[model samples]
Target: MTRVLLIGALLAAVFWVFSIVDCALQPPIRHRGVSKPVWIIIVVVFPVVGGILWFAVGRARASALAARRAPDDDPEFLDRLGSTSDQDERIRRLEEELALLDAEDDDPRWRRPVPPPAASQSTAPGDPADKPADRPGDGDDDARDQRGAAGA
Candidate 1:
């Protein structure tokens, strides 16, 4: 009898620790009843009772296998199960599009759009509009240009 009581006390302590850890790990949004902090306090203060309450009221229910309702309660899961026909239609449409693209590829004359030839105004090596010939000694030209602009 004394051994059984000791084992029971040990089990209760283990259960209390497990419940407290699980409750602490659960995010506030996932907690159902009171709040995560309150649940933790409850579990710490009362071991067996708090663990039972946590399982009963504090844990969040999974959408796929939540506690009680009719089979049709989850319409999204039902829709997923019923999507074979929609998937077949989608695959057919994609195959048709691929065939059209392959036909276009087979014809050498049906080529992708080409950009128009670049204008010749810029003689610089890189992109003409982006970089200019200005360098270390270019400040003289800029000062002259600014002076000219101010005068104008």
Candidate 2:
């Protein structure tokens, strides 16, 4: 009995407070029976019944609901005429990109990075490139030689 009474009292207080806040935040015309100031007075005067009525009877229509919702949830905006071609174009572009990515995956340039040099193949003494080549011996010296020959 005590618990029930306490719960009911808490609920009444919450509803009263939320009603006051909601009434204050809402636009004037949205209140069904009275203006914003009157609604605030009513909610404070008759907390439970007034709060319940505020939600039940004073609720806004779908269009008015849009004023409070995110743009995505705005019914009018979502229902507005749109071109299917735009979606199709986006999908086509994405598919083309994905196909290119697939082709890249097959190409060696995009292949999984060469595995790190095998543990057994120690780095050559004083090699400038740290842990070059996925495996040992694939090193800076060979690359430098090729460049040097090209330069000559």
Candidate 3:
């Protein structure tokens, strides 16, 4: 008999804890008669009785829970969304932009041209013509050669 009483008390305590957690976790709108905090207080203060009351009276009905909807899923909210014409206009603008891009791809003027080097610029460093000693009118040896050519 004492063991039976202890087991019953243990079950009640577990039920009380479960009820308090359930009540506290519930959203305010899901509470039936009173606010969520009040429900939590009721469950906390009365322990086993509070937990039973919370499950029986305070919790929202299954139908009410089932009736809740997210904003995107709600019919009234979807109806308030802008008309198809606005979406069509935006799509048309996007198509126009894509057409412009396609036209640019086919147009010669839109192509980037690789420019030829200017005549005044020297060749790359490894070339004999690019060496300072080989270049005309550059250093003392070139000036001497020019004077010798003039004298000849």
User: Model 3, range 92-126, lDDT digits (tens) per residue?
Assistant: 99999999988779677888997988788667878
Using TM-score as the yardstick, the better of models 1 and 2 is: 1
Candidate 1 deviant stretches above 4 angstroms: 64-152
Please tell me which predicted candidate would have the highest TM-score against the true structure.
3
Clashing pairs in 3: none
What are the runs in model 2 whose C-alpha is more than 4 Å off?
Answer: 62-152
Tell how far residue 103 is off in model 2, in angstroms.
Answer: 73
Q: Write the per-residue lDDT of candidate 2 for residues 1-152, one digit (tens) a residue.
A: 99999999999999899999998988776777667888888889999998988888775655755356776787777777366887799889999999997777666776678777767645678866555543324643344555223323
Q: Report the lDDT tens digits of candidate 1 across residue range 46-131.
A: 88999989988888866623556566786766766647888899999999999998877866578777889988785556654565
Point out the worst 10-residue segment of candidate 2 by lDDT: 143-152
Q: Which ranking of candidates, highest TM-score first? A: 3, 1, 2
The model with the greater lDDT, 2 or 3, is 3
Q: What is the lDDT of residue 128 in candidate 3?
A: 59
Go through the candidates in order and give the C-alpha RMSD of each one to the true structure: 15.6, 17.3, 13.4
Which residue pairs collide, candidate 1? none
